[model samples]
Target: MTSIPWLTILVFLPLVGALLCLLSWHSAALCRWLALATSWGVFTLTAGLFAAFRQGGAGWLLYEDHAWIAPLGIRYTLGLDGISLLLVLLTGFLMVVAVLVSWRVTRFSAAYFALLLGMEAGILGVFLALDLVLFYLFWELMLIPMLFLIGIWGHAGRAPAAVKFFLFTLAGSLLMLIAIIGLHLVHVEAGGAPSFALEALRGTALPARVEPWLYAAFLLAFALKVPLLPLHTWLPDAHTEAPTAGSVILAGLLLKTGVYGLLRFGLPLFPNAAAASLPWLAVPALVGIFYAAWIAYVQTDAKRLVAYASVAHMGFVVLGLAAWNQTALEGSILQLLSHGITTAALFALVGMIDERAHTRRLDELGGLWGRVPRLGFFFLLFCLAALGLPGLNNFVGEIMILIGAFQTRPWWGAAAFVGVVFAAAYMLRLVQAVLWGPPRRRDFWPDLDVREGVVLVALALAALWIGLYPAPLLQPLQAPVADLLGQVPLGPGPGGVP
Candidate 1:
């Protein structure tokens, strides 16, 4: 164990920045610089952690534990496995991007930056925390800042969108809280020490009768965050109404938390339950893939279209997780990272376009290639990535997912293959409408500014890096994912258990 508490520093650094931003509420420039510098510092620290990280080492790294509420057996514990380290890096990277993109937010600037930093802190903590209570606190802590971001700084319909987002997430969280407490109670009842420690709880076997219900509670909370299928209505509205930075964070970081929770907590904690629920979960994931794609095809609002595309993309992630094999799970994690980079870039592009054009409707956006070639080119690159073009980040993850899903169930793979086709169709349509169609307005639209180009290029480079060389990313995930799969008993052949 390193004596320095690197994980604690990583988690709390953003909170410290937010406090500074709050203190300098009158100076927007100082606030922006503080938030940006803080975010970049966090990213730099994360890179250091990654450099020190040993691939295929023990499942948890940089472990930190401290007594808290000793009478109730609650402890403040934080650690990172390969899966979490990747997410922490993603969170830090996106926080920098969010700060950069929000450079234009002049309304209540200090509060806005403060909330953004606070949200980043919460997200980092959620990825790092090892105790159930600590995890839940970080989880709920994310909600308040996000709610304020949407409600205070978003478009005209922001109020309702924020409320819907809150209610859906809150309801799901309450269920998870019940499950968390119930799991601890089960530990106590089983004559074990009562603890909210995840590893400890994972060892407590509940009665088969109660396991399914408890698993369902956790699943519902995560699914809503994933916003899988029927539980996904709030996502489009929230994404469409939120400000650019808000949408970027929501798409890039928040959505992944759902999938992460499932892999980190839900599956291992209730292996049998997760195994049995695979088929049931697979159906909704498959449904979300096609349904969201179809909806995206008909959307006029460009932002809303991207929002729907997120649903379809995340559907692949859920399906991959349900497969519960090393290949599929690793692909699912890659998809989480790739989707975050690609989707956040797309949302950022849309925001930039909207800022200039004062509109996001596809009908109003055409022939941008002539006006803003730089912007159009980057948009095209991310679009190709989003559609899973070969040699792009999205392709690697999607192909691995399909192959893994096939190994589990031929039809599951086939259906997901069809979703890929749907993805290409809708994404191309979006491309054609926004970039190649006849000009809608004769007014000159400027290409990306230096700052904007830097943001898009950085994101594109990440996508390109992942696309060409994924071995480093894949290697780290192997042990953690294999550990997760080992928890679920397998049959002689594929798809035998479910």
Candidate 2:
């Protein structure tokens, strides 16, 4: 029973489901139902994993390792720690949301569902893979399906958006590949058996001069995906052009991978370099927080506004990571989960609105509160959460991040506080315009049906759970985050406080 390979099954189950989806190519109904069932099964299995999980465990749990690509010393390794565990769970939950939101897709439905399942598999593998090479394989696997999702099924500007996304991601990926190969070469030269396994390579001393360059390569790759600052141009375009399911997955899951990469690989692999580069990273994060918030405040398109809001929210995650403290890291992780749920819900609502009104223009939408009371309530709930209102999910994460940042540097905290204010301004404006502004049309708009209500209610409950008591999530993260911090060269206990 101990040899059941649960992690392997979790990672591959969606890919198997995708194959099954292809078999029902002519039957869109079967394809949709099968995809929904498979995703829900995965979510249920993840819950089981959670129930059986040993809290406060020191290292990876449900560990499995196998030899692969012997010449390069890569292994088919998978495992979960507190950090990856939450992310894998988020991935599973969001896959269900993504599939449900796409329930109405009628054109090329089979291929669409299959691609969704395929992307879910890749995202799961990314969260679970412990081998660097295997991680890269999963990382690349996530791109293709998303590319097609945007290009084939997205809005009017899908083609250009898809191309832009592919190019930016490809450029970053190439740099990351170079860094991975460089690390392997360095290991071989150090008279060690070449290995791309994380445990094997972690803290492996590299030449001081070469280390910074390698860190930069990885940082650039991840920052681009985090789409940090100037590197974030592709995100708005991608979000605006993608279909509802694509946007939900992009905002909820794919973006988190970049932050995950930073925590998992960037800092731990090159602590000294990471410490040296903190200000460089933190400044752009701070700037992006304000920059994106201001841009979001002025957007005409509803989805585009939400897209920019993602940039601002993710900036907080970056800032927390740069702070390099346990509280900050834990807050960043919570932000990851909270942002995934809240933002995905927002996107789903926007999709519903677009479906009804056939327009995302803010000026064109108003006074919907009277027509779609259920949707209005959920929209306001998620909006409040997004703006960091007290007792909501985003508030908890943001407060912790600021507290942690202030401990590291008061000025960083102060600057980020301004971002919080701007967040409230922009989000409130959105709520006011979409729900209470003058009605652009008098036609009756339908409230959420049972399926949509179920989705929103589930997300609302998750948000409330985190806001009221984050300890369940925070407790599991403490041990792993503390362990990760131990590897870094900064902070009070590391011989010198930064």
TM-score of each: 0.98, 0.98
- Ten contiguous residues with the weakest lDDT in model 1: 489-498
Query: Could you tell me which residue pairs clash in candidate 2?
Result: none
lDDT, candidate 2, 64-176, per-residue tens: 99889898899999988888889888899999999999999989998999999999999999999889999999999897899999999999999999999999989989999
lDDT of 1 at 137: 95
lDDT of 1 by residue, 157-260 (tens): 99999999999989988999999999999999999897999989999979989999999999999999997999999999999999999999999999999999
What global local distance difference test value does model 2 have?
A: 0.91
